[model samples]
Target: MTVSPAPREHDVLTDLLTQVGYRNEKAFAELYRRTSARLFGLCMRMMGDPDDAEETLQECFVVVWHRAPLFDPRLAGAMTWLMAIARNKAIDRLRQRPRTQGARDIDWDALPDTSPGPAEDGENDLAYRRLSDCLGALENRQRYCVRDAFFSGLTYVELAERMQVPLGTMKSWIRRALQQLRACMTP
Candidate 1:
C-alpha cells in the first residue's frame, strides 16, 4: 500500500512556518519532527536508493529553512507546500543522471523498506485511503504509469519508451489518468 508522509491539518504547521520564516529554530525542529520521515520516504521512492533519498531529504529541508520566510499559505497548506519541495528535490536528483533503460522498470514487487508503512486512523490516514481508492479505480496501465512516473521522476518520453508506447500516447494516458485522479479526489 502507498502512503503519504504528512497530514493535511496544516493550520498549526502554517503558524510554525511563520515562526520558521523568522528563523525560529524550535519551530523548524518541530516541523522536521512531524514531516521528516514522510519526506524521506518520498525522496527514497523518487531516487530509488536510500543514500540519495537521504541526501535529497536533507537538501529539501535546508531549502525549506531558507525559504520558509517566503512561504505563502494562500497557495497551499503547509505540508502540501513542503512535500512539493521534497518532490522537486527528488526529481532534480533523478534528472541529474542519464536515464538508464534498467532504471525504467522498478521492481513493484513490494513496498520499499524506507516507507513508514501503514498509518493509524486519522486525517492523514483518511486522506491516504481516499487517494488509494481513487488510484484503485484506475486501469492497471494508467495506475502503474502515474505511480511510476511520479515516484521515479521519469519523463513522459522515458515512460513511453519503457511502456513500449508512443510519447504522445503516454502523455495522453497520464493526462487522462490525472484527470481521473482529480475527479476522484474531489470531495
Candidate 2:
C-alpha cells in the first residue's frame, strides 16, 4: 500500500471542519483523504484485529464528519485531537470484545447492592421512576439497545455487531432513543 505524506501542522483542517459542519461532502472527503491512514494505523496498533481496526477507523471518520466543527485547536493541535479521537474509538472497540472464553456465569446474590442512604435513596428512586417512564416510551429495538448499553455495559459498536446492523444505523437508533427519553423526562 502507498503511504501518504504526513499532514502539515498549519493546514486548515479546522476550516475544512467548518465546511463539514455545513454538510459539505467534498470537504469531508478531503479531510478523510488527508487523515485516514494515520488514524487507521493507530487503530490497527491499539486494536490488533484488522476488522476491528477498520471499523474503528470508519467510526472515527464519521465522528469527524459529523462533529468536526466542535474541534478546538487551542485545547489540542489538529493531529493530537484527531489521534485522541482515533485512540478512544479503538479502545472502545477493543473493550466491547471478549478476549477469553465464553461469558462466565455468576450468581446475582454474590453482588453487593450499593444503593445509597435514605435521602439519596429517595432521589435515586425518583430518578429510576423517571428513567423507567421515559424508557417505556421508546420503540422496542431502541429500548433494547439502551438497556443493553446501560445494564450490560455494551458500547454502540458492540451493539451494532450483536444486532447485525451497520454502526451508523445503530448510532441513529440510540440517538433517537435518547432524544425520545429526554423529551419524556423533560418537565
Candidate 3:
C-alpha cells in the first residue's frame, strides 16, 4: 500500500526553503506543483483571460523564487503570503499598458470641459474639509509633511527638497505624523 506525506511535509519544505538557495529549481518546481492550480484559477478569475493568467502565474513564481529568503513564517501562513504575491503580480500584468501621447496639439478651449458635477464636487469638498480639519489638529510641521506626502504624492526625497529639510528629518516627521493620524482616527 502507498502512503501519503503528512501536512508537516509542506511545513518542512518551507523551513528548508530559507536554507536552500533559489537556484534549486527542483524545490521551486515542488512548490509550484502544490500551489500553481489555485493561483492560476485566481488569476484567471481576476484577469478574465486564460493566456494572461498563465503569464501572470509564471511571473508570480519567478518572484516567489527570488523572494523566498524574505518570507517570514511568523507573520503569516506560507500560502497567504504566496497568494498575496500571486494576486499582486496578476493585478500588475492586467493593469500594464503603453501610455501613448499624440504629437498634434489642439486648442485647449475646443475641448469639452466635463468637470465633475456639483454633487461630486460637494462630496469631495466635504471629505477634504473633514481631512483638513483633522489635519489642522496636528502639529504644524507634522501636518505639512503629511499633506505633501499624501496629497502631492511626493516621496521623502521630494518632500525634503521642497521643504528644504534633511531626508532623515522628513522621514522622522512623516513617521510621527502617521502615528498621530492613526491615533486620532482611532476611537
Among these predictions, the greatest TM-score belongs to 1
Can you give the lDDT of residue 185 in candidate 2? 78
**For residue 167, what is the lDDT in candidate 1?**
94
Which consecutive 10 residues in model 3 have the weakest lDDT in total?
Answer: 99-108
Go through the candidates in order and give the C-alpha RMSD of each one to the true structure: 6.3, 15.5, 14.6
Report residue 177 deviation for candidate 1 (angstroms): 0.8
lDDT for each of the candidates?
0.81, 0.69, 0.64
Q: Give per-residue lDDT, candidate 2, residue 103.
A: 21
Lowest summed lDDT over 10 consecutive residues: which window, candidate 1? 114-123
lDDT of 3 by residue, 147-179 (tens): 545423346876787678999999999998888
Q: How close is candidate 2 to the true structure, as a TM-score?
A: 0.47
TM-score, one value per model: 0.78, 0.47, 0.46
Ranking, lDDT, top scorer first: 1, 2, 3
lDDT of 1 by residue, 1-187 (tens): 9886764446667888889999999999988887788888778767778998999999999999999999998877677788889998988888887655245466654774544322222235556679888999999999889988877777898889888999999999999999999999999
Off by over 4 Å in 1: 1-12, 72-75, 101-104, 107-109, 112-126
- Residue 22 alpha-carbon offset, candidate 3, angstroms: 5.0
